[model samples]
Target: MPRRWLMAALLALVPAGAGATPVNAYPDIARAYWVEIDGRPAWAGNADQAMPVASLAKLMAALVLDEEADLAGTVTVSRAASAATGTRLGVRAGETYLASDLFSAMLVRSANDVCRALADWHGGGDDDTFVARMNARAAELGMVSTRFANACGHDAPGQGSSARDLALLARAVMARPRIMEDARRESFAFASLDGRRFSVRSTNALLGQFPGAIGLKTGFTPGAGRCLVALAERDGHEVLAILLHAPDRWWDTVGLLELAFDQARRNAPPE
Candidate 1:
């Protein structure tokens, strides 16, 4: 049988309506996928394919910030940062914001300006250096299929990563206390050096909508389509779902999490 038909057959086992979780019903539109259950690989489909990941790459920026940069200091926004497009924070050149605040903007709001601002600050006013650090860190983490060309995850020709590599990065991000806390919150608030107040809300919609949903990140571009790295914890079991170009990410993630936990439960020895 064809793959789509097989998937459909598998999904037919799920009951409709109340308490039904569609297992193996991932959308055909998804380009690459990976899921980890309790820190172990549970599913994979073309998870090593290098493709544009859009704002998901900003997770690396957050990782880099946590490892190398001074997160508590103040960073001045440069023209390069102020000029960032595709998700703006309305920051202007010559403005100064807390490095911690900018980091919050990058994760919570997916603000490209903060990505650039933080990178520039870390690189001593040079983004290239920061990108080099990102690549190096990815390599150190065994992300062989990943590369970063820019601080913000813009669609550049050479900028691409695989789902598996991103999963590894996500594990590292979750290990850090600050990064995990930032991901869990819906919004981060702070005042600028100029004393203007600003609040940035996270782009991850699953927080309030889905039970046990914590965070990760979301990415999209004309080329990347809808991408998401979702983390959900229930009954002390954690599941991480990574989907690239998935048109129905929120639903798929929920289903995938349900299936993972169910499978794990079935495999457990009787007490």
Candidate 2:
């Protein structure tokens, strides 16, 4: 099916007044944002505007890896991966590590090195191949407004994602129990085949501080600014909020989640 037709079909299913963009609800919230309560859009702003999303792109890479790669398999780091910029696990070239370990660090710490390594491994020594797979998967997921330039979320021309597109991506990630399990963790400990110990903590600050906060992802870049995909559950209600280029993501996410849950309660069918 055509991507636009797929998106239109998806939008048509939203309940009346369910997915309206209310810019006034939260001023200066972000460049683009979207919030959903149990898969139902509650509020949004610039939801379809394509913009830099930083490491949030990793979510899509992680999704592609989960579907195509074996977690139990091992991967050897490449020079390109070892030299990756931004946040990284500091993995040296030629080091061998479990794909699962690299996956954990990539998601939790936003480690660029390990992310690149995994991408190289999955691409059979070519990151571009992996990126092509990411783009193909994005289209399949109805993320028409997204594009991937690299395995690690790096700033590059022609690489961007929209708030709504990321919401769709996040939903796919949430469906994977293993990925969610790793994402929610406060920290992860692992070692390479040569016995190099490494410890990494979750970049998602909400894990311990926010009520019912669980596994999600965070990102930042000079171009992308601070981005976040926050998921929280309370009383069987799940709230997922995506913020791109948010200046105050921590506070904004908390407020958005609270509002989403409240809205969910208010809109509940009368008992």
Candidate 3:
């Protein structure tokens, strides 16, 4: 009798065999995925289908700059680069910066102007050439679901990427030793071409809010509401989380991360 009751209680705790949380429970998100450091797919829903990434696309822009430009090289900011819309680094025409500085700005601050400047300064020869190279790099990286029409991740009607493609790209960026360091920075400063100092703060609200929340990026537009690709580290394990088309991106992202960490802990071997 006691043994039968124990079995029932244990079964009750099993939670229907660990399926994903209900969609209505998280109504704001269109799709998401949480990936372990070992490249294991832990949780996913609507991960393979392509969707608007908004400013999260800037992650690719930063990676492309990291690969193609010498971080120490100087770039003279063009009028076109400085005049870009949305969030900016407040750079002016004729301003110049070390390529790495712009890369930092692009990743840490999601600076639209810095992205354009970096693309123009080192993307083959011109803006068009640089955008082409970005797309080519995406293909080479097996981001078949991704298409880059601009360096700053502007709201182009057709430009988008799947959660799988983003996972691949995030893996590629995280693989580089320097990128982790760059993304983890909370703030950065640099001098423009005119020698004026510029300092930028990160847009990822969870950086210091949640435990082990590293840096990624945050984005939105009317067409794409509240997007994020965030990384967190706990107990020597790293997990990447991506959320798209979310309305309450801040709390939703935090909730997903907490759930992922909880799941990881439950699955971990006893210490």
Residue 241 Cα positional deviation in candidate 2, in Å, after optimal superposition: 0.6
Cα error, candidate 3, residue 236 (Å): 2.0
Weakest 10 consecutive residues of candidate 2 by summed lDDT: 4-13
Rank order by TM-score, top first? 2, 1, 3
Which is better, 1 or 3, measured by TM-score? 1
Tens-place lDDT per residue, model 3, 1-271, is: 3453334334323221234332222323455543443245555557666777878888787777777668888888888988999888788888767887788878888888888888888865488788788788889999988887777778886688877788888888887766777788888888876679988888888887889987677887666667888899988766687777776777766666665566566666798
Could you give candidate 2's per-residue lDDT for residues 176-200 as a string of tens digits? 9878988899999999999999998
Question: Which residue ranges in model 1 land beyond 4 Å of their true spot?
Answer: 1-29
Pairs of residues at least 3 apart in sequence or in different chains that clash in candidate 3 = 96-193
Candidate 2 or 3, higher lDDT? 2
Native-vs-model 1 lDDT?
Answer: 0.82
Which is the better candidate, 1 or 2, if ranked by lDDT? 2
Give the TM-scores of the predictions, in the order they appear.
0.89, 0.91, 0.86
Per-residue lDDT tens digits for candidate 1, residues 91-145, read 8788888898888878888988878988999999999999999999999999999
